[model samples]
Target: MTKPTLYLHIGAGKSGSSSIQAALARCAVPLREQGFLVPGDKLEPDATVSGHQLWFFQGLPKDEPESQKKVLRRLLRCKNAMAEQECHSLVVSAENLINRRKFPDLFLDVDKHFRVVVIAYLRRQDQYIQAHWQQWGFKSHPDFDDWIANGLGDIANWDVALADWEAAAFKKQIIVRTFERPKLHGNDVVLDFFNILGLDGKTFDLGNTEQNRGFSELTLRIAERNRDLFDGPHDNRFFAFLGEHLGSVVYEKEGGSIHLGKEDRQRLLDRFRAGNERLRKTYFPDQETLFDESNLPDRLELSEAEWSQREHDLIWRLLFAMHRRK
Candidate 1:
């Protein structure tokens, strides 16, 4: 019997991971028939989401060795189950796995039984930070400067993140791909991910599904003001209601555009310029730059008075929305 192969899509998040995972789940039966099993979908605690967050959580470091021992046992059982089903390929999709410093160590025992492949998708630093900033605002309002200096700012520096994953993967090749559409194999993320797995894109039924749309500027303003009142571990329902109903409202309003200033954006680009160049040369040698910025819309700067007026209007809308909900 041939040994099974395991693919790890350990992510640099906000890189269309949710969509890819959803597609994987949609095609799981067909993929299994084709000898590929996406076990992550089944392992997710919430059937609606398509990530193996529980597996990632199990492997996250804890103070006690017992937790690690239990995780290893669970992994062993999972592998045995896959083998019994005669599945020759298993995919583990978890964006959070990249944050686990002991990434390779988590699978040292499993490697002895199967082939391990590590794959990652990366976006340009400029685009990555912009998208991440929007996502972060959904959960909490953090000052962009402080957020950059602390939370997500360092994540876009691909050189550092990739290097860390490479070191953890031991002898395995870390297959890296750019998230830019033109650079992607099929110019579609789900198709691109499947292409890497040696599957024909035509075989899968990918639906028109959108996941985790970020908060708009007006929504962000409301979230910033009310975070202390309603933000907590169990408030995703409230956030979802705001995003689904009000995200578009913000876009239609005049002067509602909220984004980093040109100076700040340029500073972020400059900070990552040298690192991005290195990454392109190392992974994507065909590209001149990690990102093509010639087509980006010019930033629209709002004066203090304009911003204040916008905020006052947005607050009214927020309060009205809340009152209606009640």
Candidate 2:
């Protein structure tokens, strides 16, 4: 027997990857009872439960190519170990496996284990670009506009991402989840994926949506403290510690909207309009036949003040009390 295996949960930029991973980690025991080992190698029922890959970038020396490669090697070893163990299922989650200047060792390592199907839930491009910017800003990556400015030339092209995935033998399972549909209503988005795997319906109870209702005060605090990239890696202890604390406030931030200016927003929307069309033609030929992008929010931006609130700490405490740390 080939042994039941799957290499999935690849994501498009920032569509609830953290939330999904965190939820799965939270539901580890119950899900395992149904026969799915979220992170097969952990040997525990938990998914490679904590930490985000982008956090590692906070530890890299900006100008050092050798240093970049070294950290990636470390990332790959950890991901590979998680994938190789014998189990009914396994999942690896990371956003940069697509965009960055290059991929981490996890890409190659994932290839060796199972037939990989890339699960990328795409929102319209305009929203994606804006959300990416909000993230950079929240993480203290210079002025928010600066990151968007640099995203022009190659960044406008999402197809390049498809090409990169092709190199790793990954097939795209791009589910264009619209903003209107589930609005990520609750566990629907997650349960949909679970059903794709043919798992039983023991459904997950999603926690409060308020705590993650934007980046939160905690994230803003860290970004403020670690604003300089060049000065970052030297503060590994700071980043690691702050990161754990920040993790608490990372639930989905509901309301608030970012204003990326009409011109800039339209320009990005146009790019995604064109780019998404190309994605349909070049990759997912029959987009209409595949998935709909119409309802997916055109732009899911996090307004500036959304991250400025101090009330987040109190909310974080409450969230931890209800959910507790894993």
Candidate 3:
């Protein structure tokens, strides 16, 4: 029997991961026919982005003994399924896998089943922060300034993260792809991933939808102020409706760009410059720069008081929307 191949899409985060996971789940049956097995539907249905999340969650350090026992069973089940399918390759994708320091140890549990390959996509540092902040700001008070001061280092420092993953014992070849659309193969991440795997597009049902669109700063600020209202269990349905409606309402006004103060932008660029350069030289010798920085914009042209007024107005509108839902 041919040794199976295991491909792990370890995301650099905020780089279209939801879309990729959805694509894999959507095309599972067709993929299996082509000898690629993406197992996880038993833990989560293919309709959701967390379809392959069990593999990632199981890999993390767990405090509960019962849960740890389940992890081994899960791995054994996956191996058996692969054997039954006669699959030559298996793929498990999750953004959390990219930055997890204990990544190598996590895969040691299943390394005997297959040869491992790590695939990742890196986004521009500035864009990565804005995208991440907007997502978290919707659920909590992801203070932008605080993130810049404390969280930026890990998120922006691709070199360190990549280096650690490369050093991991389970890692075979690490395929690094830039998240920029123009730079991506066929201008689509899903297609580009298929290219990396050398899979025939006609062999799989390659359908996809855009997922996790970024919220505007104004929308995020409003969401942050009212985070308590949506944080509880009662708010899940309400937020689901809000997420759908808000996209259309904000679509026209959204510039699709996160504004940062010129000084702050320069600070971010300078901070990541050496690290990004080293990353490119180490992994992408042909590329001069890891990311494009020419079009970064200055902060939104609004004073604090004016921005606060807008927040108040947005809160009122949000309350009205909730009332209308009732």
Task: Choose the strongest candidate by TM-score.
Answer: 3
Candidate 1 has a TM-score of 0.80
Among residues 3 or more apart in sequence or in different chains, the pairs in candidate 1 whose N, CA or C atoms overlap within 3 Å are none
Q: Write the per-residue lDDT of candidate 3 for residues 158-203, one digit (tens) a residue.
A: 8878778777664347888889889877788777888788875545
Q: Which ten residues in a row have the lowest lDDT in candidate 3?
A: 42-51
Q: Write the candidate numbers in order of decreasing TM-score.
A: 3, 1, 2
lDDT by residue (tens digit), candidate 1, 81-195: 6767777777778876665556555665666666778888887666677767656533554576676776663567777766776665543467888778887777877788888
The estimated TM-scores of all candidates read 0.80, 0.59, 0.81
RMSD, candidate 2, Å: 7.9
Q: Name the best candidate (by lDDT).
A: 3
Better of 1 and 2 by lDDT: 1
Q: Ranking under lDDT, best-scoring first?
A: 3, 1, 2
User: Whole-model lDDT, candidate 3?
Assistant: 0.68
Among all windows of 10 consecutive residues in model 2, the one with the lowest summed lDDT is: 208-217
lDDT of 2: 0.49
Residue 25 accuracy (lDDT) in model 2: 62
User: Which residue runs of candidate 3 sit more than 4 Å off their true CA positions?
Assistant: 41-50, 54-59, 63-73, 137-142, 151-153, 170-172, 232-239, 251-253, 256-259, 303-326
How far residue 180's Cα lies from its native spot in candidate 2, in Å, is 5.9
Residue range 6-41, candidate 2, lDDT tens digits? 445545555656565666666656655565555422
Global lDDT of each candidate: 0.66, 0.49, 0.68
